[model samples]
Target: MKKIGILTINDYNNYGNRLQNYAAQEVLKSLGYHVETVINNTDFNKKNNKSTISNNKIQKIKKITPQKILKKVALLLRNNYFYNKRLETFRNQRIKVFKEFTSSYIIETDISITESNIPNEIVDRYDYFVTGSDQVWNPNYRKGSPIDFLTFAPKNKRIAFAPSFGVSEIPKEYHQNYKKWLTEMHGLSVREEAGAKIIKNLTGRNATVLIDPTLMLTKEKWLSISKLPLNKPKGKYLLTYFLGDISRERKKYIKEIAENNDLQIVNLLQIKEKFAYMAGPDELIDYISTASILCTDSFHGAVFSILLETPFIIYDRENQSSTHSMNSRIDTLLSTFRLESRLAKNIKNNKEIFEVDFSHVQAILDEERRKTYGYLKAVLNI
Candidate 1:
């Protein structure tokens, strides 16, 4: 089998990022390739060193004098300037590991590409490379530059699967840079249609829109590998993700709706819930499957709600935008799947009861994945 390298954000604790990374790895295995992951560990020191920032220190900073705050800002600017100078070179170095996954398997590099110290032996090895799943292309990731992937220079081929620019719109300077990257890529698929349009506007290329990494696998497949709830709650409850800003209003609205329905809220973060902490992919899928109704702000949260065929409302709670600009990508998905009525009905009156049918969106996701897989296979010459 051919060897392939997959690059994505892989934090062991963050379920969403982990699921996407695992899904990318599984997809490559399905295509009959021997896959290995190249991770960057820029945040390793922070993740490993728990003492870097303390709650006490944060509280103290919060209460510090204005002069101290100004001094802190000055220090931050100096630190950032020095950090950027070491980023690219630091990322080019790497380390190799032979992990046991049923059998012996190898994973090369750390989690943060910008600060990775990959060994020379693993630097230029691999038939092709993939960068993506969760906002790998987000400009914020590489300090407003696309140099992270470019610096690797993977030989043979390169692809970006279900990658996201992670924003509704692209800025002008980055827009030009994106076009350059697209021209070099052998294959590309974006998770959101808004991103696809942004690419087209910037590059005039008909980039394929695809499903989130979570939808690439079935609920059954996820359950097989997922961590089970510590204990299943005996009572019925609603599941929802907490978002900022409008969340308070949306939460109030949804709670009222649930109360009227006589169902309890199974606040995932609260005690007595099955998946209490940072949940994994399978745990999330199982929770969605069991939820009576889901209210959420996250795209994957919405995706799982549909995947489970559970009724849900797409509560727009992101303070980042007003009703007009708020998660238009989400609006697009809801409208495309005939959930516009539900959105309108929910917003028209949060008290108004409604149900959503996700069969159409699920089908669309499947079709998109089929096309995405086809493109991937073509790039890998499978």
Candidate 2:
């Protein structure tokens, strides 16, 4: 069998990142290709070693005065003493969840590599390399790394499938670099139209706009792997999967909607909640699938809600700036399915429960899936 290696942001604790990785692997496997996710341990270690918010704050305080330095040390000790159990629990659960999910669903490289350290044996093992279905090209996420551009692969072996820039525009300084790296892709596709436009302007390449790999699978396929949490709420519940901050106004609206609808609000990202903190991809799908209504500020949250045919309200991310806005992904997705009305722009206008008819949405998804499969088949010569 032909072998394919997928390079993506797979080491994160986020539901969307891991699910997209698994989805891409499964899709390729179904095509009769042996697929393995490349685990870059050096990148993973670097991300984990980065200073936390409290550590960064403590660093600022250390330079103030001798007394403040003492206070900073005390604060650090106190925080570690008080929160160690919860922090350890979160870490252990997340690691277990990732291990269980990946071992059961996806194959991964036994050896991890950094950009400067990739083995030729590893490179030669794959017939083709896919760089991927997430924000791998987003500069903020990549931290100026060229790994996501398949720089390690030979020009003829590189393929980009629904890889996202995660921003509306690329910075001017990186245009030349993007052009150079992307010039070598044998087949190119992006998750958003804005990304496709950026590629066109930079490399004069007309990239295809493809659906996320998570959407390439049917709902039945997803449901087959989804496992409900033991403590899943029994009654009708309003599921919230916000990745960004929730404003007071939005919080009020969410509460009001839940109260009026007699629904319990289940927050998937609420750190204070044990259940939320322990949720993995399977639990995430279970919550969205079982929810009476879903509210989120997440791209994957909206994607799964739509796929499950659950009524949902998508909120814009808080504190979006000109250069770093991620709302375009959600905007493009809603527009594609003709479900723009589902966007919760104003609380007053969204007083009633939102209802979505997925019949038309399913038709659009079917056509997009067809195009995506056709692109992959032609590019891989399957």
Candidate 3:
């Protein structure tokens, strides 16, 4: 079998990131490639790239002394100490949840890849190198990570599949490097039309816009691996997942929707919601799959909702007008499915929000999957 190494966002705390990593691996595996995700250990290269110290000293430690709470009672007396402690606990639990999915579903390189240590010997090990169905190209996210573009690999071996810039426009700061790095790739594709447009302007070459890898798999495939959260409600419930702070008005609207749908509300990202906050990727699939309605501002939340054929409302982030806003990707996703009506901008009535039609989604998904497969096959030269 041919060997392929996937370089994506080296994040484990996100549901979408982990899911996309697995999706890319499985899709590549199905195509007869021995796949492993390249782990970017930027955090591990502490000798040369040491992180600056913040006022909160406890944030740096991640080992034995970090767990001893009573011994550090003095720090607890500081302002907002309890709040910081709550956040630390949430991070620990959620990472554990995400780690389970990575361990079971994805194969990773034994040696973590970092800028200083590329493991030069492994450059020839992979027949091809792919960079992602996630926002690996997003400068704000990866800070123009050359690793994402497979800069370490030979030009003929680089392939970009459904990678996102996360914003509508590439910042001026990244333009020069972005152009050179992208121009060198053997194949290029993006998740949103904006990214394709950006590429066209930069390299004067058109990039195919494809659906995210998460949507490439059928709902049945997702359900087969989904595990039920032990504390899932016996009855119907509305699920709320937001990466940014949700407005009070949105919360009121969510409550009204839940009341109208006769469903209990479950806030998955709320740190105080212990059970829901600790939900694994498999449990997250079930949560979204089984939701009466999902109200979220995340791109993947919208992706999964459509795949599961569930009713959902996509919210515009508070930073929608900012250059760093991620609204464009969600805009593209909704537009592609003709579900632009699902985006909550001016709908005042709760009934109008749930009046979504998904009858035509499957056909679209099938075609996008076909296109994704074709692109991957062509890029891999199969």
Tens digits of per-residue lDDT for model 1, 234-291: 6777776644444465667777877877787766533234244434345667777777
lDDT winner between candidates 1 and 2 = 2
User: Model 3, range 1-382, lDDT digits (tens) per residue?
Assistant: 8999999886778999999999988898989999999888765334335444444555533332745765554554553577777888889878987987899999998877877788977798889999998888877667777888889999999999799999888889889999999999999999998889999999999999998999888899999999999789999999999998888888997898888879899998898788999999999999999998899999999999999988898888774557788988898999999998887874667776767789999999888889989999898888
Candidate 1: C-alpha RMSD to true structure equals 8.2
Please report, as a residue range, the 10-residue window in candidate 1 with the lowest summed lDDT.
Answer: 93-102
Measured by TM-score, the strongest candidate is 2
Q: Considering every candidate listed, which one attains the maximal lDDT?
A: 3
Clashing pairs in 3: none
**What is candidate 2's TM-score against the reference?**
0.91
- Per-candidate TM equals 0.74, 0.91, 0.90
- Give Cα-based local distance difference scores for all models: 0.63, 0.85, 0.86
TM-score of 1: 0.74
lDDT-based ranking: 3, 2, 1
